[model samples]
Target chain A: MPETFDSPPRFDTVLIANRGEIATRIQKACRELGLKTVVVYSEADRQAPYGKTADSALCIGPSSAAKSYLNKDALLLAARLTGAGAIHPGYGFLSENAAFADAVEKAGLAFIGPSASSIEAMGDKISAKRAMIAAGVPCVPGPDTALSDDPAAVERLALEIGYPVIIKAAGGGGGRGMRVVPEAGLLQEAVALTREEARQAFGSPSLYMEKFLQHPRHIEIQVLCDTHGNAVWLGHRDCSMQRRHQKVVEEAPAPGISPDVIRPVGRACVEACRQIGYQGVGTFEFLYEDGAFYFIEMNTRLQVEHPVTEMTSGIDIVQAQIKVAQGDPLELAQADVKCEGHAFECRINAENPDTFLPSAGVITSLALPEGMGIRVDTHIHAGYKVPPYYDSLIAKLIVHAPTRAEAMARMREALAGTRVDGISTNIPFLRALFEDSAFTRGETDIHYLEQWLKQRRAP
Target chain B: MSAIDFSDPATIAFLTEALTAAGASGLEISWPGGRLRIVIATGNEAGVDVSVTPRPAPTAQPLVVVKAPMAGHFYPGSPSRQAATDRLPSVLAADILGFLRVGPLLLPLCAGRAGILTKQLAEPDALVGFGDPLFEIEPQS
Candidate 1:
């Protein structure tokens, strides 16, 4: 049943402030909602299929991301020019930028995500930890405050938290602006270097310390919330396959974890959202080790690896986010949420299989998998030019099956059927990873991919 | 050679804006006694600045297609004047060829150099995006 909304729809048209596959994803959702779509692109993405098919496509700036996708003023101006009443900032770029969200709301446009205050609350690592603890979310053992400048005091704090602590920037994410110290000797130097880096990179030298888990597996809970204080936890995901803190592959209902162990954590994440008055979709990322979950951070936007959860949980997260932005109450309760089958998502990047350098060129030929349980979300086609200006993720290959082993087999088949010509891709690397005995047995840690790559490189 | 007064503050301003919009690393022109360069710095989100001893012209010329610096509504001329909007194929001299309106702001679209405006690619009052070709110009050789 559709809940009543007292106000008229907040937006009749949505301006997609993103590019590539995610932009294509959002446009499809808007089409289903019967809302007019406006897609913005950088000059390099002039030939993007989403832009071509959108109700109105506009190039917001030049090829440089800073001048285009990251340019907040340009995005707002584009929305105004196109008479778009809302803007959906897909993952990456300015998706989590609190200032952009505030500016969007100030411009009388829906931002299609949480309010600026909620984003700010979760953006700061220390504040986020405090919020999580308040909501009964388990966090890594550490103080919920910024580190002091006093060297002696800092050393004492480190001693209290024990060595092997990680120093992180308050305003940083995507695995940058952090330093992991394995012992006391390197603590001060690491702190100094990281603080300076944080100041230079994130515009603030404020740093915090936490116990660095040595063998934690990356896990996260997907959550959806409405403005009416109703929220639901969709399910959990295992994104342990990482290279340099970037998730290369992800799966749903993380293998081998009992539902009893994760259910409380999922409930806590939903509680955190409600406590902060969160709206729209978000991900509560964690580091799990020894059957325990530690809250890390909350990505206050739609995640790149959301498809695996969508396949298992059977929800159109992007469309739900839009509906929540339009002031609609959540249509489903926690009881309606169900994780049916296992799923896997491999991020197909346009890069060298070994060196991982970005490969940008026109696709001379293309072949992607088809058939039941195999879905490839991509915006590329034959003759499509992979732009060198942005993230190298060109496509996502997702497969679902009733069991994890069957899903692995399905993914292997899909990967075998895939072919991209005229440019290098990580297809070879993904195929090789799928065959790894440890990965196949679902017994890999967050550091497993790097260790695997290191072993592969050893003579 | 052409009489492009690179020293004119208006020309420098126009060139800097154009360089930033085009994502050009920088622009350098040299002639008899002077030289001018406008660099669009990669850091700090494309901050463009030019220090000029400004005097001069060109070694070569090519057709230039002026595109929008950012997204906005494209106007062929001062909208208040009815006849100016329809006038096309006119000769331009490093001057304002059109205007791009964003709300109350009307950003002048300059040609950057002397040329014959051969075509207007965008419709009057049309919402044009960045890098949308607005005018085609054949520069004087």
Candidate 2:
């Protein structure tokens, strides 16, 4: 048995400040750990099935997310009322909010995530890049500092980086607050426009520039750290299948890259996590191009695409995060970490396949596939009402196999067996993408999905 | 069981008051001695008149539900007055019905309309979220 730390703060109950499938997922993990769970819901989700299974459930507010899920005080109050010793922010909403994490800690309840300072450090794009560079991690060729006010210096910096460069806000992520200038002529104007937009949006006008990789793939490394300084990277995932800068599909082992090629980057990520004293689970997002990986940003919370990594590594990441929060040391070292099989996750969104418009209504009928190598994570069921106020993602369909090809085949079969009625979904589009020759061949960039959709629309 | 004395006016008046207090329209007690029927008038005119037949259902009085303005631990009344529920408090539109303790802040919950607070819907010291009903009031006729 691994040596245990002496008398760390242990929590017996956890309050999940999230909704939908993730809430159900966290409750399951808490139950397995012999911990009680308190599930909070908005009026829109009062009928959510997960609420019935929790140790206790509370209605935090009305249908608006701002008045409910995103309300920090409401979540804290709910935690206090339910006698929960910890709060689990399951991605999205307040998951990445540093102030919320700090407030949770201040309230004397474990935040079940990294320290607030760590979140702040990683939230800023420039500071995160600097930390990555300091840890000897590969990053895009650019100075690890924000752009100066002088237009001439900005122009010179862009020229030095190369013809095509991207100016990004220091406080931005999720593909927002960025402008790519292909040549020097548009550099100053792009910088000015982005600066103004950044000021209005992110509360800061600071900007940075980087050499743009025209055809880079979005790859991410999942890392788990404990309070005892031990950290390990589970594996890498390819999330290049996206639309409107939102990932739609993800697969683990990031096909075609060998362990030898990725091990160095993974090691650097672990080093970076230790350097910054990051705890719990985080994802190091990188852009891979021409056999080289460049660090982009790090998500300081569990990711929506975490299931792919979980399937490939055979690790329950949610449980691991909770254990780490309980002040447990790493049970396994980097050498013990193994990436076993390939896995793919398709985000089942409640939206029109053609127009991508959200479809929210009662699910009149439903059927999910269940067999070897197939898993469905969802809180939706027959007669479950899909609220129009939140995210469109209703479920995640994951499949795993010994090889990528087999995983793909299993996913196709699973998708075929799945059925949902009374609401439009992107299942048809996903089925078509699975049959695409290029996607089946395994390598596609972030822009491939949008281009593929456009081509399909052409007469 | 002994048969009820339906011929007694005292028994009939007692039954009429019971139906009025329970918010029911009418009640009929048929014993072997005789049948006793009572009906109450169905309007804002507040008096129970004993009659021999069922009258129309009572008109519903408008009610004002004092809801929580924010999420916090609910106190039925101020710290000095802890037994607010023991006696129904008559309140004006701006009367303080309770307080919502959120962290260091204590937000006052108003009655929002003039009425007799007929019920305390939320338990004292229970956590209440925004718009959760705390008190139900029947507006004065």
The candidate maximizing TM-score is 1
Give the clashing residue pairs of candidate 1, or none. none
- Candidate 2 residues lying further than 4 Å off, grouped into runs, are A1-8, B1-62, B72-91, B95-108, B116-118
Give all TM-scores, in the order shown. 0.87, 0.85
- How accurate locally is residue B22 in candidate 1, as Cα lDDT from 0 to 100? 77
In the range A274-353, model 1's lDDT, one tens digit per residue, is 88888899999999999999999999999999999999999999999999999999999999998999999999999999
Evaluated at residue A338, the lDDT of candidate 2 is: 86
List model 2 lDDT by residue over A86-112, tens digit each: 999999999999999999988989988
TM-score of chain B of 2: 0.54
lDDT tens digits by residue: candidate 2, B1-141: 565555567777777777788888776666533456676777622343333444347776768788887668888876656555789878788788788887787888888888788999999888776678999998875
Clashing pairs in 2: none
lDDT of 1 at A431: 99
Q: What is the TM-score of chain A alone in each candidate?
A: 0.98, 0.98
